[model samples]
Target: MKARDLIVLVGVIGIVLMMVLPLPKMLLDILLIINISMALMILLIAMNTKEALEFSIFPAILLITTLFRIALNVSSTKLILGEGDAGEVIKTFGEWVSQGNIAIGLVVFLILVVVQFIVITKGSERVAEVAARFTLDAMPGKQMAIDADLNAGLINEQQAKERREKIESEADFYGAMDGASKFVKGDAIASIVILIINLVGGFIIGMAMHGMPFKDAANTYSILSIGDGLVSQIPALLISTAAGLIVTRSATKGNLAEDLSTQMLAYPKLLYIVAGTIAMLGLFTPITVMSTLPFAAILAYAGYRMQQNLEQKAVSEEQLEEEQQIEEVRSPESVINLLQVDPIEFEFGYGLIPLADVQQGGDLLDRIIMIRRQCALELGLVVPVIRIRDNIQLKPNEYIIKIKGNIVARGELLLNHYLAMSPGYDDDSVTGIETMEPAFGLPALWVDEAMKERAEVSGYTVVDPPSVVATHLTEIIKKHAHELIGRQETKGLVETVKEQHPAIVEELIPNLMNIGDVQKVLANLLREKISIRDLVTIFETLADYGTYTKDPDILTEYVRQALARQITQQYSIPGETLRVITVGPTLEKKIADSVQQNEQGSYLAMDPGTTQQVFQRFQEQIGRLVQSGYQPIVLASPGIRMYLRQLMERTMQDIPVLSYNELEPNVEIQSVGVVNV
Candidate 1:
């Protein structure tokens, strides 16, 4: 057992000793033992643990056991007035009782017992309340994971049964505590009735013990000690025991047991102190305070203090709420102002062509050309031309080159199986991956050249690429892994993450099952082809139809093949030479905003070369739309308006810049028919 438990055992023994011995002589020992036990118990129980059973049972058992022991020793004869040597001691006790000392003793005993009972019942109810609140806001993903686990045959029926049982047991246990909320009203009446019974019993018993003739009139001083000690000790013990039992029975299985044992061991210290002090007062001094009156005054003072503290706590809470409101009002602006460059300027990309400025379009390609003209009109510079390459499977050389290039730059260039399986290069050749290396090196060299030119030119520009850093990946892993991964990986990864990914270890994420990088790359490919439902269905089948965990990589490649066929059909762009005219600031802002809002951080600034790559991504999305049997077209960013003007000027530059006020008469009418101008 714990040291606190040991201390409680000592206290119990000491209390038993005090009751058996003469009261005044052993009182100090009793008080000392009780106080030590109470302190130790409180300290031990206050430490948070997975199982929280200390609150309810401890108070009940401790107070009741102490009270019961004390009650057995309580006698009316101890308070009777007499004229003899033993009678002198009795007279002294009577005088103490006549004074307020006995009342102090009685109230102390009663309060300890009543409070214990309240703590037990109320504490249990409080735990239930907390559990209910916790369950209410639990996410749908948590339930979904449980369902997935069941379907996957992870946990057996018995284990599931036990889990439900535990949940229900906790619920019912707390429900019982709600009934205990009514016990406070019962305690008030019980206390009053006990007081009356004790007073009447004490009067009769004291008269008989003192060997005095039964008088109808009461000896107020002599009967007072008897009334105080009897009522306080016996009734208090009964109430505490009753409360403990009620709370214990009502609480979840095993809840009350721990708390009861603890309380049974701890609370008697207060009683011991009160008992010792009252005994000391009787022995050492002559007293004149009224017993019941002092008790009543103490009770009133305690009530007042409780009320004051409660009011203060409420006021503190209100002030904290007001402070939070004030902080919230300023926080958003503070976050905005903290950045030196305007966030809005960064949100909108530099360029896109709007269609209104375009002269004419007769086909799908012509329509795209019109969009290009619109972007030139809106932004001052040449529009960056995007050429989409849909469903182009990466050769092994391409994968190796991308991988090596990414490694040099401390980044990852992930490739799906279609790329690995592509028959563009023979693996037997020296530096088989060397052919892939050129794809990235050429871009890097172009970026370097552009950077140098931009330094020389006033309006030099380039596009930015996507930011896929370790920090972002860590966050995704923590959130999605729980939903995606199964038991073995979950158990292993949880520990691995704690050691390696300390930043993300605590995050509750969606599980991702066993398929790793291969699956991610495969999904990216499928994202370009299949509709969302088809992709979800394919993954479900891969998990259910075949052996999944052993070779997820191969399964990933297979899925990518199905995705590749769809990709080649819808958006196959055929081109080699690409042209790009970098756009100006105003249109850049508008386009960037559109991308930020619509896509999930997919668009990032890059070179005119990177624009071609972005078009490829767009082609995949458009392909998915087409295969799903929808006519798909990229919505030109607003920045395209400026670019359209340039395109028109190259074809026919005589037209003036159109104003919003002149749209109906100047631009729209001219496009519809011959204009008077």
Candidate 2:
């Protein structure tokens, strides 16, 4: 084993030996000196550590040191009782501190015991117990904050992990301290008990065994007992003080001495007041002027000097700030920085501050984080961090959501009110401010908290202000999700899949199509509100059919056909027939005949009049389907599905066009309407 490990192991074994065996006076003296030195070192280290975690091994060290001290006491007690001399160190201490007065030495030792056990050890133990409880209680909140920062892109994954680990370490450290404090308390009690035993037992041995006179034996044993007690109690007091410091110390950038001086002497006005109070006491009280005037003069001088230093520091700080501002203005990078824009931005009016500020119970940021995760799950897109700020130019209750510097949606909210939407029964019994739901454009009302119960009783769905803005933001992101996935995002997605399906990505990318082509196909799928989460299937379809055509639109259609089961399950209600609108066979044949192809790809070559007639028929049939309360889905042949969707995309953006081949065989279909041209 290494030398350090061997030394530690031997040291621990030596401590156990000290308890079981008697020690020579010379060896006992050396161990006693070492104990005193170790206690002093512990006290100094505790004072210098800026945080508890900086000295995380302190609890284990404390246990070892406490054991070592008790073992030394055992050996010293044996030497003093059996041989009448514990060590030169103990005898010298007893003489120097007590000055031959055994009563004085005994009183001093008892005082130290009381101070350590009653004041420092007890208070530190209580503080450690409370600290451990509170640290564990706040752990969940700290973890959630870390997660929020990670999702918002404020910190990367490594930093988040480090923060989480630090929180856990803090909890464990405080818990260990809570248990370690008990050791110091028990050590204090052991000191007192050992002191009593040494006195009582030493007197009996010196008189009965050595046949000494009563006065001589009393003097000899009392002095020896007092000396031993003082030797042990002094180090115990120092260690107890150190324990107090460790538990009470708050985390700081500076050590204990620096923090104390900086905080205690921060304001010169307080020192000036102290100087004035001393002068008043010197003049108004019975105290002599000669004794008080000098101290008062010193206080006054120190206060004046501190005041001057404060003014100088303020002036220097102002000058430094001015220099920084001048440098920032002169820097060329400042101009370039203005051109950068956030991918997504959220701006709110001053009145809505409480809805975004965490301290004020605003959970808008948390909601935004959830929205990003939701988008990733449903649409397979990564939403960027939304930069939130306040705009004074807008109305007090208004907020806006923007994508890439353009405003997409805006809404207004009342801070102290809940929004209520009717359940389609046209119940107007509950009165409130009328408004429109920002997410769905349904009529809603801003009802006060007192009216929330009545609104609920009237069969209206109620929501809070933050929920309103979050719901609106969710919809806006879903609608513009296609634009968010670019070349970089597409590459990231492919690299992620490559970790799991390396062969498929390697065979398809750069061999049949590049990253940009794949991006376009994914974008097309997202544009039609189809999830690209099944990437393995999408890539497999591309690898099989990409050689036939390099067109992204055609590739997307093939990908859709491969994902037929997922698409059908997404739109179809379980155990219900799929309701759809079908084109008449004659009209389908006409569309098929109108298709034209060239090197540049296919296009519709029908006459303008015939195309107009087809569009009008679609409008009429879709309108009839809507009037009959049926969701309108256009069914067409696989060859014509893409063309049909392209023709109707402008006018029927919400309608989903499907091919017969994309439908599963087990799914039952019901044609609700027919189109003819």
Candidate 3:
């Protein structure tokens, strides 16, 4: 039988048992049956739909516990009546009522009822969601078929076929993104505004009704009721609903007005409930309208507040402007142009060596155009495009013809000329490889001085790397007369600075890579402007993971450079720096290696995409960095920060890693000083 049919049968049996069978004489049995029925109603609804069910279990439990406690107290109080108890019980009950216990009982009862209403509404919502899902599951199969014909050769038929099948199979179920609780900002604000207005308006209405000034009315009611009673409730409800309407209306671009109106149509039912609750109070009690008004007002306001908060959140113009600026800052074209290659023909890791070697830069232009087209298709965007406009020498031994373009959908394309050099890239692994490349370019440490200044200026939480250890690095290159030009330096400290195999460095010529920071620092140190001690202090002071200390400013430059390289290496957008911004042992070594290996004036800017990707890749890279005798430090988000702090504290007590969160707002610092071996 259907679940609904089974429910009906059970209900009928329950009714029959109530009338014909004496299974239990206690009222608790009846209450249990009622609870079961209520629960079943909720279960049926949720089983058929896809909405999330939110239950305030604590409130419900408290309400129930209080009611039972009151009941037991009252029952025990009646036990005081003995043989003359019949008359005495009645007299005592009357006395209790006369003494204002009745008023307290009524207040408790009202609160419990309100809680019940909330629970019921929540349960009904769950049921509706489940029912909707069940309805979707009942759709016909042929109607779900893919629109494309496999016989047509117009597209990649195999891929098309698979996509269609996947879509069809998943169509029966709603995606997490498609759920009704997709909250918006405008809705939330609207709801809150409306709720506040209702509260204020309710008081005004009560003042008018009581023939007193608003302030006097409030004071008077505050005495009789615990606070301003339900007299102000109706207006508050109206106001809150109106607020929700305004917010939802704005967010939906007026598409949701009808829904708001439909919800408002339930006001009459709310009124009935309110009226009935008021009427249920005893006439002989000292209960005043003032005492009950606030509760009613709160109840009336809650619905509007909830609806508004759930649906009306909006994105402001300021946020949009910021996003646009960020987009400009991270323009893939800039990163790609740094590498100096055409984007189209060279995407997907193909034709790299000859393209990089060829100087004219004409044969690669078509490939750059193709990349732009592909990005347009993928992200479905139409933003102004930027392309790599210059030739960037990335390293002495390795160079890529790079191209960059802005597509409408995908933001910026950082096309690397070296993809043509990497073997074994397929369609699936393309994005994966691109995502990983950025992590390799992160810096050993990121400084957040700019972020701190911005935070002070804006009065907002700053994203800066936490202060842990104070470390620095220095590299010195000497030009001596009479030295052979080809003289090889001994296997020096740089070999140990970065953990890569010496063989790999020899073959890859990582030293030839153009990383400007290392060169600049070295130059400054050689000029005696910055001491070697200061360099070591800077290096050692950074978080162990190089740039992952949750400090945005400190990591931004390295992240930007990494983004450039990642875009190039992964997506064939060539002008990426592939930087890693971190303070861990491994990251510090990488920085040292970059300084030691890279030629002067060879550094490049990375795309923003690579920076974000590298941040994400830190976990995996930490292990590699550590295995090479390099320690890493990682940053934490708000929720995880405390736990991470504790774990780090325990692990580093012996090694002495320091952490400080009070440096600047929203920025924490953790660092490990290098051992002077």
Candidate 4:
């Protein structure tokens, strides 16, 4: 395809051909020099990389280099045996190292082999294996931490995806290195084998075919063989060291040179100690003081210079920090940052900090995570990250929960005491500070650890401080869940459902209604404490009846009737009849007659006098239902149910107003009271 890719393919093919075809001495010499240069460059690059992943392609490079070296060994061996000479490079290397003495050259070659094979190669292989194992093992933990950060709103979806990809890449890079290290080890062994073959084959060929005596043949072939070995082994040693460096590199902010300079010389005092040691060793151990004194003086001077640099650096850093702080105060973005409000916030005083501190055995964060999950299941809305912090503005034992920067609920906790509430009536004998349960406003007492068991035995519901706070926080979120789901959040729900049920989404959305229309319906349901988890059913209903009316109110009524079974199950127990307050025919007629219509849609326009009478009568019925511990559900005809709800919403927001059709036919309903006006 492209020039570079073609060159790579040709290079690989040439390496294979080198083993079978005899190349010219000049070409072989050039190839050998190129190999050495490549190896040196690789070593330099490895040292400069800050992390192993920065050179992720190294494993492939290692394999290719090893193969190229082996091919060169084969070509060189053939030339010495067949042509009586391998190449000028090999000859120069052999002569230069041996100095016309073959024994010295052979010893030097053997030492390179021992160090490359036994030390560098072996250690690199082990480190690669361990690195790979640890990377793979840490993947799950890293992935979960990313998810937690995403849920906490510390990172967005794109950032989370990038983190996940990085984790997988690290695992793959280490695993490849684990296998690639073996090639370097095998290349070492192959070099030794090729060296032996070159020596034995060259000797036999020189004497048998070239008519040379034993002494002459030994001298000639010995230099050629050792020369070939030395030329290859030098590059192999460099590469082996490079491999070790790459695998052992950790993820830090700087390259090897930078890290070495900063960390090893971080303390100038250490250099002073080393200088003293050198001076003492020369003076007391009978070594020449002249030999060590100059080195010791240089070390002391360097330490002195480094200490001066450190002091100047500290002064410059302080100046820079002050300048940055001044600039930040003048910047518009600083003010802008304060304007951004968190969707939900939990602030507690200093004394209650232990409730959120993990080291103090507090599990408020863990509880918040669970609370978010519970809200998702119950309300079918993803609660935004609850920002938790300590505020010195409040009383020591006081805490407050805010929704959209406005304080919605506040409570005080006695961390050392357990909240004990009587089951039905007051327990005068259970002596403790009087308090009201913040979640439900029920009368309760804060009893210490001593009286906890006694209160429990006396039919009092006991809960710890964390649980009390968690319950209050949960109730506040549930009460305000409708405010949290806007068009953006509704779109999220629609996308989630689209992933699983595409047919309903594609046909319903933007065809009969848009996101805003769907948002209004979802908000209405959440406002009434209805779970929208069954999205497939909701979409199906919307698609079925959406063409008749674009009004969210009427559409919601249709959806409720379609979800009758769910609503029935929500109100009625398995074998118990549902008790409800019934709206009489006279009030229903008044509401139905008062329905007024305009271009925007219909709304209840009843007179204030009739609305007042209705509220007075509805509150009486609701009072009876509450005293009897029955959920105050107002049942009315389909035509007037929504109107009645609109009237009672402000006064009795927690009460459920249901139409007769919004219940299952098989369920029995008992009317406990009637409201007529």
Give the top-scoring candidate (TM-score).
Answer: 4
Pairs with steric clashes in candidate 2:
none
All models, RMSD in angstroms: 23.4, 10.7, 31.7, 8.9
On residues 238-257, what C-alpha lDDT tens digit does candidate 1 reach at each position? 44344334443433334444
Which is better, 1 or 2, measured by TM-score? 2
In model 1, the runs with Cα more than 4 Å from the true position are 1-103, 106-151, 164-168, 175-188, 200-677
Candidate 1 Cα lDDT to native: 0.38
Worst 10 residues of 4 by lDDT: 422-431
lDDT on C-alpha atoms for all candidate structures: 0.38, 0.88, 0.32, 0.91
265-294: candidate 2 lDDT, tens digit per residue = 777677767777887888999988876778
Using Cα atoms with residue i matched to residue i, what is each candidate's TM-score against the true structure? 0.30, 0.57, 0.19, 0.70
Off by over 4 Å in 2: 1-330, 593-600, 603-612
Measured with C-alpha atoms, the lDDT of residue 331 in candidate 2 is 98
User: Pairing residues by index, what is the TM-score of model 2?
Assistant: 0.57
Model 3 error, position 79 (Å): 18
Candidate 1 lDDT score at position 438: 25
- Name the regions of candidate 4 deviating beyond 4 angstroms: 1-46, 49-105, 113-232, 239-329
In candidate 1 the C-alpha lDDT for residue 338 amounts to 47
